[model samples]
Target: MRVLVVEDHEELAETVAAGLRREGMAVDLALDGPTALERAEINGYDVVVLDRDLPGVHGDQVCRTLAAGGSRARVLMLTASGTVADRVAGL
Candidate 1:
């Protein structure tokens, strides 16, 4: 699987990427929202491990934009802010 990891936290992103790599999945990392979006748009990723809160643009916006733009990759939102309202807002 080709996975795109969008995260601002370096350590967490690296850890996740390393674990995914160990699992035999190809991993790509982006530390900010714009870079994430750019990567997502340019690459054919199978899955996007997106952080809800990010610099440049939020993950939610990224998801919406990608969907609107007809991206085929599935998004798995990862966020520290866990709430019904937050999830709804993300959607």
Candidate 2:
């Protein structure tokens, strides 16, 4: 599967991408929200591993844009906040 790993943390992003690659999946890395959106626009990704608190556009906005643009890629949002409210809000 083709996956986009979007995280502001460079090391984490690279590590995730590397792990996905080792799993025999095609992976791309995006450090921030805007870059993630740009890459998503240019590439057909099966999944997007998105960081919720992104630098440029924010993960929710990125997901919204993708949905509005009719992208079929699945989005998995990650966040440091583990609160129930945060999880519900993200959903």
Where's the lowest-lDDT run of ten residues in candidate 2? 11-20
* Per-candidate local distance difference test: 0.93, 0.94
Work out how many backbone clashes candidate 2 has. 0
* Global fold similarity of model 1 (TM-score): 0.95
Query: Which candidate leads the pack in TM-score?
Result: 2
Candidate 2: the clashing residue pairs are: none
For model 2, residues 10-83, the per-residue Cα lDDT tens digits are: 99999989999999999999999999999999999999999999998989999999999999999999899899
TM-score of each: 0.95, 0.97
Would you give me the overall lDDT of model 2? 0.94
Q: Give the runs in model 1 whose Cα sits over 4 Å from its true position.
A: none
